[model samples]
Target: MAYLTLFLTAFAAATLLPAYSEVMLGAMVTQDYSLWWLWFWATAGNTLGSVVNGVIGRQVDRFKEKRWFPVTEEQLEKARNRFNRYGQWSLLLGWMPLGGDALTLIGGVMRVPWLNFVVLVAIGKGVRYGFVLWLVLNTAGVPSESVPSP
Candidate 1:
């Protein structure tokens, strides 16, 4: 149940919706949950959420003519220009806070190969979760071995 909650939180956090999975991860770390399991579930959930965003990005153009379209033509153009300049490598920074979600979405807009998208997103998000786990463990003086790996 704890891991499921972590997975759900991480998934939501990866979307455009506002969520703070790091806070939950840190709190869970303090409680001595299995580090490996936490990292695995969080990474998996976050990556899946980003993939969903990418899928939505692929279909975003269909909604361009809608009265409620969220992105303006100019805004879309700017995003497209920035993404083209960066290329698929920008997916490495998809784990960042501000423009991270946008980066993932743009990858889809630009037709980045799906396998490449998954690999890059998974690597980025996995590293982020690992760092958060390490930070929490050290800050709490909880030896990595003190917690089970599971």
Candidate 2:
């Protein structure tokens, strides 16, 4: 149940929705949950959520003509231009809070291959979760047992 909650929180956090999985992870670390499991579930859930954003982005063009379309053509073009400049390597920074979600969305808009998208996103999110876990363990002084290899 604890892992489920963390997974869900991490998933939501990776989306456009506002969530703070790091806080949950930090708190859980203090409680001495298995570090490997926490890292795995959080990384997997977050990567999956980013994939959801990518899926939505792929379909965004179909709705561009609608009244409720969220982004303007100019704004989208600008994002596209930036994404093109950076290319797929930008996916490595998808762990950032402010623009990370946008990166994943633009990836889909640019027609990034699914395999590339998943691999890059998973690596980025996995490293982020790993860092969060490390920070929690080191800062909170979690015992050695909680720091086992993942």
Candidate 3:
């Protein structure tokens, strides 16, 4: 159940929603949970959320190249060219704090390859979770064996 909650929190955080999945993971680490499972579920869930962002981006592209569309065709063209040259680099930023979600969505608009998306997202999210776990462990110290009763 805790794993599922962590997965959901991470997933929601990856989306446009304002969430702090890292805090949840950090708190869990202060408890006695298995670090490996927590990191895996968090990374997996966050990457899956970014996948949804990519799909939304693909759908956004279907909008006829109207003046009202958020990005001009020329701009999108430039992005596509850049993505072709950079391949998986931009995706590594997709796990960042503010701009990360937008990066994943743009990756889809630019028609980045799906396999590349998954792999880069996974790597980025894994690194992020690892960092969060490290911070929690370092700051929170080892988990206490028991909580004193009130």
On TM-score, the candidate that comes out on top is 2
**Most lDDT-accurate candidate:** 1
Error of 2 at 92 (Å): 0.9
lDDT against the true structure, per candidate, is 0.90, 0.89, 0.83
Models, CA RMSD each = 1.5, 1.5, 4.1
Higher-lDDT candidate among 1 and 2? 1
Off by over 4 Å in 3: 64-85, 143-150
Each model's TM-score?
0.92, 0.93, 0.83
Per-residue lDDT tens digits for candidate 1, residues 25-140, read 98888575777898999999999999988998899888978989989988998999999997898998999998899999989888899999999999999999999988877787
Model 1, global lDDT? 0.90
**lDDT score of residue 50 within candidate 3:** 97
> Tens digit of lDDT per residue, candidate 2, span 1-150?
999999999999989788999999888776647788999999988999999989988998998888899899999999999999989989989999989999999998888999999999999999999999778777787777645554
Top-down TM-score ranking: 2, 1, 3
Which pairs of residues collide in candidate 3? none
Q: In candidate 2, residue 34 scores what lDDT? A: 76
